[model samples]
Target chain A: MGSNDLQKQAPNIVVWVLLLALPLWLPYVGGYMELGSRVVVLALAAMALNFLLGYTGVLSFGHAAYFGLGAYGAGMTIRYLVPSTGVGLLVGTLVGAVAGAIIGPMIIRLRGVYFAMVTIAFAQVFYFIAFRWNSVTGGDDGLTGWTRLPIHLGFTTIDILHNPVAFYFLVLAVFAVAVGVMAWLLRSPFGRTLIAIRENERRARFLGIPVDQHIWISWTISCAVVSVAGALYALLNNFVDPRALYWTQSGDFVIMAVLGGMRSFWGPLIGAAIFVVLQDYLSSQTENWMSFVGLFFVLVVMFFPRGILGIIRRKVAS
Target chain B: MTQVVLFNVFNGLIVGAFYALMALGLSLIMNLSGVINFAHGGFLAIGGYLAFTLMPYVGFWGGLVLAPILTAVLGLIVERVLVRRLYGRDPLYSLLLTFGLAFMFEDGTRFIWGAQSLPYQVPGWLLSPLSSDYFFLTGYRLFMVVIVALAVAGLFYILNRTRLGMRIRAGTLDLETVSVLGVNVRVLRNMNFGLGIYLAGLAGVLAVGQLGLQPTIGSSLIMPSFVAIIVGGLGSLPGTLLGGLLIGVASGVTTVFFPSATEAVMYVMMAAVLLVRPRGLLGEEGRF
Candidate 1:
């Protein structure tokens, strides 16, 4: 609040403190540690989705492909890769990255509704492959017993297996790192190219930028981030199922990003937090909660079409 | 093998009829308004529920006709108040805006109807059994085939023979030009949207017993209807018929042969269609 504190600290540092302290406090006192962690994970996924959809003007209805892939990868790798949570996460991220690279070229060629439909189909195929692949996926029961990150401070090794406190920190730490990376990405020269691509691909092409390649990379990065969320989600639930990768789950993340406002670095985190909390609150109240949610979604699109962040931006601009 | 084939064929034909009904309406609205009415299915659901609600008072036939007419009235209102403002804006906004409307309408129906499945029964006259030497079929299915055939023929005649049809066709090609030429394009657009929605409503009413009515039920049907639109070759009636038959058969065959892969069949088919023929099996180039 004072010039002395402003001189002593940077804005980003204060933001990090706020992000970390909330998880720490929520776990220790508020006692909604699990719900908070879940929100954080969803926020991370929603943020990644917003990059391509909201920021880049691409709408993908099949993002669950990466999410499901990441979860399944993490779950399976942990079953064999053993004891190291970080390695399992790496395994999932890399697997998702590889998958994204392969699917990226095929999907990027489409536009508007066609693109949306293709993504939806791809997600369904991903679900079917997971669902029907009984031998590897364990046929819907999902591979379980995923090991959490074992934190070793050289002389002290803290087993994070099923520890809510440890898991919260894992999610929080990754989220913080992702936010920093995403912020940097947004500010980078390459990010400017992405904006160019979004505004007009033909013009961006005429300007000598490799627009398709840029879109592909953005999509790859987007899917990679979602995969990481999927990994953490698998860890949180201690189970992996094809349901995670279902088309509906993909829609859920899209809804979150749109609700929070598609424009900013902060929109998805706020959106995800609000969405998860709202659903829990609303679903508890009525059997027709979905109807209410659908109505809420309509109102959001019609009234707050640019999103809450967009609202904030307008007010600030004015 | 013959029996299975026959069943698949029958199933395909019947399902194709439903697809044509919905796709016809969707294509009409797109043609006239230049907006892809995403809420078409919502209107369909409303029409179905309206009929379901009216069953106590008017019986089956009354519900069928009245439900769609009521839905068309709602469509008329939507076009006037909300959708008309979106004219000449980006088609994307219309898409998003209509999606929002769809969400609202779906939820509103759920709130009014309650969140449970409702059953639709075939009336006494339509309940008679159909006996054939080669195949055994429900008289209701045969009745559906005949009714849908008549609806399609009636729609075709109206579009070709009527002055209102000429206005809509002219409007679809270019609304601004039509407006400049002294046609009431706004009124045409409103009536076109209402007409499109009425078809969805009728299909919804038809779907009562087959798929039943639920809040989220129409959501699932949206994809298939879209598929029908795609297959039929955007804004073409004949193309839609051929497309619907192809899709229905493809799905029925795939479902019969591989139950697990059944759900994704339509999507897979759509992708294949796009790659091989972007305008659909019956669509012309530059349509997309």
Candidate 2:
């Protein structure tokens, strides 16, 4: 058991090292700072989704609603209400978390595909709002004319707006805090209950755990974190649109989590990284990139449903 | 004021019928097989596009009969080659597979037919309103409703009376029992899938005459179909049909007072249904 623990820690350490040194090494490998930042932001969203999907075993295909809310919240705050980036993030996260909590009750009783189907259907409400409420949401053209402000500390100011490297670190720092909290929670008793529920709901229910409540809590946490990622996505692009909340975007996030291997903690992050880079390359290469992306989904489900990390873990176990 | 309300409500009923048409097909596949066919909208698009290609050669009526058949044939092949493997596995794999297929279908249609929306011409006589006072009552709209009504009646007749329909109904109720009775479960699922796809194709042919043809035409209608199934009740075709119309009328009414919320109304209805009746308006208990 001690040896196994050490082995797990070793890979985690290597992963951290790679992530930490990404911005410094990325430019040398033909990757820009913004690309690195995009990956971190998207990976954070995927990881957040995996908390509910991979860990709690709740399948939510409409996470993009909260994610879009976060983006719109942050963007709207920065554009209309407040000019501070920190406040934008706070408001964005709050909006997403609150919405998830409110919507939780309606979907908690549903399990498996029904839950997913309802979630996807509900997400369209937000998409329509964003698309139709043009006066406030800027309609289908997307929210524009707003840019992320530079961070102002007590002693120093970080020009994240101008400096791509600074923005990458800022995203990485938030990712670290959010991912750390999730990892810590997973090791706690409450987290164990979640895992139990995921493994077998009936057994967990028999063990006197309140299954629905745990799932609701897990779902809210996942949404909150994904919203934070959404806020970051808006900050990175300095724009938010109805497309951000579209059902297709939700599918993309699911593919990221599945492609990364839902069982492993860092799997979604890796999945996000590969997906982002591949999508970037594909869009640049062909007009029919959507088909290729769709093909990727088919191929992944058919051949690598276990994901990259899953296959690696299997090899090691063998 | 009455005329405006009547116009939207009447419009809503027509739209609702279209939703019912699509939802019935989706519900059939989801009921018999545990897989939710996310690519259903894609098949609808294929149906519409196929009709468009064939119309120039076979005329509008000929294309109407043949296009859905072609779409169902394609659907049968897909069920056999791709979807069949995932039936015994987790529902997630099938959803993902179909989601991918949907993207392929949409992109494929866009690749074949230009992304620009194509005009589908109906007969000139059907283009004009039946009466001046009820100018909203175009001959085309009436024809579509009549055709849909006939198709739905045909579907129910087949389901209640025909051998294949009985097998499908039995499979949906208890596949294990049907298999125990020496029914080939694989062939049953494949045929059921083809039947559902056939409905989608029919919807495509009917819909394009009114809404026109575009790669995204099917996608726009799909969420409402899901809502329809949910609102009507899971595992109940009558419920799906009812749910589609209810939301359609709901949206149409809302359009009079709150035009912006035309699309959002159905989601609101879905939420209310889930809250008041989680099983749905007509859904069976323990089906989900």
Candidate 3:
């Protein structure tokens, strides 16, 4: 029992240690701060997606809509509303949340694959808007001429604009808060209900849980978190495009969650790390990278369907 | 102005026909086997590309017939080897597997044929407008519409009349009952999948003539097809057909007034359908 406890705790310790010392050892491993930041941003997105697919037991294939909404929301806020990065994040998150809340009712009736189909279809509306609304959105070339500004924290002015390391830390702090809230929610009664619904909806409904209402709420929360990830993504690159909101990007996020092991808390982050790194390397190395990525997806579904964490957990259980 | 409107409406109907054709195939597979076939568009691309490659050896008419058959053969192989294993498992796995295949198929086509759009040649007579006044009605467009109509008629005839069609419909309604009655469930599903792919292949051959052959062709048409399935209601082949045409006309008409909202109009119609009748216009209750 004691050894089991130690084994369970080891992953947490190792994960934190790696994250904390990433900057120090990254260069030694031929990695840069920007790449590290990209991993965190994508990991957050995948984790946010996992909040629905993994934890809540919902499959939303159109999350890129909310993610893109957050991005555009943040970009538009900074460009048009205010120059404040904090305000941009807030507006961006709210925009995604509001969209999700509105769209949830129309889709809550669908189950499984139908729900996924509808979500993917609905997501195209946003992509079209972004592509067609050229004056504001910058169309296919992407929204440019905007950059993240220095953050003023009352006492100290942190110049996240100039220093890449500062930006990475800022991203990390946001990620921590977002992930912390998700963890706290998962432990609550409400969170348990979400899991219960995922496991067996009829049973949960029989137990007096308002299944549809709870799912709608879960869907909203998932979209909201993914939107925050989207906002962070825009801030990371200082640009947003229609492709960011496309269905293919949604597929990428789903693959990340599945690749990491949906049942585990940090599995998506691990998956994101591997996927982002592989994609970065592949895109740099070959023009046929898409075929490789697609092949990777097939291979994973065939061989690693349980995911890394799932396999590890199984071994431990046995 | 009237001529332009008529032209677009006619054009929309043609586009809608393509949507209906693709969605029908998708609906067939989904109804029987419970797989979304995300790579249906990819199969469509393969059909078009195969036709392109074979045109030198087998004339356009020959390629048109042979390409879809070839594509259907490939689809059978895929369903048997890869997709067959996923049955009796969660629908999620099948969707994901197909999604991956979609990616591979897109990239594979691009690798083989090059990413650039290739022009597909038709007979010179087919290119000319049927009449000078309503110049939008080219011989090819009319020919496409007639072919689609024939295909739909043939499909309905098979489903309603033939033994294989009855078996498929029966299997869709109750697989357990059909299997208990001595129908080979595995072969039934494989054949059903092939039937669906045949439609996709047909769409591909028709589509390339109008849209030109490109790797991204499948991805582009996929969304509208999904909308057609949703709007038509799940599990209803006729509804899928109607939904495709309705959205096509809607978008076509939209171009007359607000050109920018053409694509958005389809989703708007889908949203309206969901609002009014969530089960869809002709969808059976509780089918979803």
Candidate 4:
């Protein structure tokens, strides 16, 4: 990230301490932190999307396809070939990037609803492949009976997944580092190009920016980053379903993106937290919980067009 | 083989009528306002539930008529308050706004009607029109086809010939010019939005006799509506009908042969269409 951005982040570095320390207090906090861990991972993914969408005007409706694919890559790897979390992660990201590359060529041709529709279509295609290609992907029931790696340095073994605290710390570390990278990217000249692309593609094209390529690269990296969240979600949930790859999953991601206020990275994080909390709270109370949730969505989209965090930040800045 | 083909073709036409009923309003709205009414299916779902509620008093026929009326009124309010604000905003805002409205309407109906699919019976006249050894067809579907055909013809006549049709065409071509010509643009817009929504509601009413109305049907229907529009070409009325018919027939035929591929059929069709013609089968340049 740029020096100015780094300086700006310095004041918020206490958040890093809190996130890292959550694992230490996990023995006390327990289930809450586990959910918190999942939320943070999703938030990180949404943050990446906000970078592409809010900053660059590229709204990806099929992002969950990449996410589910990455999760499948990790889970499938552990189930069959390699068992290292790090390698699984690398492999998952590679699969995501590869998928993004394949999808990217046609995506730049669409903008607005057309682009969104194409993403939805691609996500559905991926989901169908995952479902219909039953022998390889395990189909509807999903690939289960997989194992998580035990952390060891060739001397002693500690089952990382067994200890929620260790897993929490791992997620926090990864999330923080990813966010840091995103912060840096946003401050770079390339980030300016993304912003310029978002504001006016015609102008950027006039200014000699490889506009389509910029969109292509931004979308690809966005998918790659979001894939990390997918992998983590699978690891956290201990299972993956075609549902994870469904267009509805993409809808949820869009909801979180809009709810968090897409203007900033932290907005998505906060939005993700609120979304998870509300989901848990509402579902626990009533089966008709979607009604409340739907109303909440309507109110948010209508009254607070900038989203919850956007309103708060506006107030603070003013 | 002929029987199977004929059966599938008849089935496709029956279902195509429903698709036409669902998509025609969306095409009309997109024509008048430069906005895509993503909530089209949600209104359909509302009509289904509203029909379900009116079953005891209105009977199926009366309920069918009432649903569209109520929905059109709802459409007017929505256009006046919500959609009008988005006149000059980015199309994304319209997409998201309509999406949000769809969610609210669907879930609100669910809150009142519950999430379970409500049971519905076809009216007596249409319930037992035909039963045969090789083929059995629900008379209600045929009835829906006839009803939708009438609606389509009526809409086509109005849009192509009426005095109001000229204004709508003018507005679609350039709303600013129509406004400058001293037309009551706001009233026309509200009427247009209401008219479009009425069609969606009417489609929903007709649909209840064929399929049970559930909480999530709106989400299910939205994609196909999109596929129809995309294939037919956005904002093109005739295109919407053709697109709807092609998709309905194709997907229905595919389902008979390959049941498992039914869900992915629309996307497959869309992809193939894009490969052959990126502007859709009937889409013109600069429509987006």
* Model 2 pairs in collision: B233-B283
Q: Score the docking of each candidate (DockQ).
A: 0.30, 0.88, 0.79, 0.44
Candidate 4 reaches a DockQ of: 0.44
Q: Which ten residues in a row have the lowest lDDT in candidate 4 chain A?
A: A22-31
Query: Please, what are the lDDT tens digits per residue for candidate 3 over residues A155-230?
Result: 9999998898999999999998999999899999999999999999999999999999998998999999999999
* TM-score of chain B in each prediction: 0.94, 0.98, 0.99, 0.94
Model 1, stretches more than 4 Å misplaced? A1-14, A24-31, A76-84, A94-99, A127-158, A240-243, A246-248, B30-38, B81-116, B124-129, B132-135, B158-163, B231-238
lDDT of 4 by residue, B1-288 (tens): 677867777777777777877888887787787677768888988888888788789888789889889988988998998888877766656766776677677778777877788888767868774778444476877778888989999888877899777788789888999999999998888888888888888888888777677877777776677778777877678888998888888877877888778657877887787777777877888776
User: Which tens-of-lDDT digit does each residue in A90-207 have in candidate 4?
Assistant: 7877888789877787667678767776676678777888898778788999878776677676787656678876777777777877788888888899998899999999899999
In the range B83-186, model 2's lDDT, one tens digit per residue, is 99998787888999999999999999999998999999888999999899888999999998898899899889888999889999999999999999999999
Worst lDDT run of 10 residues, candidate 1 chain A, spans A22-31
- TM-score, cand. 3: 0.98
Identify the superior model by lDDT, candidate 2 or candidate 4. 2
Better model by lDDT: candidate 2 vs candidate 3: 2
* Decreasing lDDT order of the candidates: 2, 3, 4, 1
lDDT (10s digit) by residue, model 2, range A189-233: 999899999999999999899999999999999999999999999
Interface RMSD per candidate: 3.5, 0.6, 0.9, 2.5
Candidate 4 CAPRI grade: acceptable
Local distance difference test values of all predictions, in order: 0.77, 0.93, 0.92, 0.79
B70, model 1: CA deviation in Å? Answer: 1.7
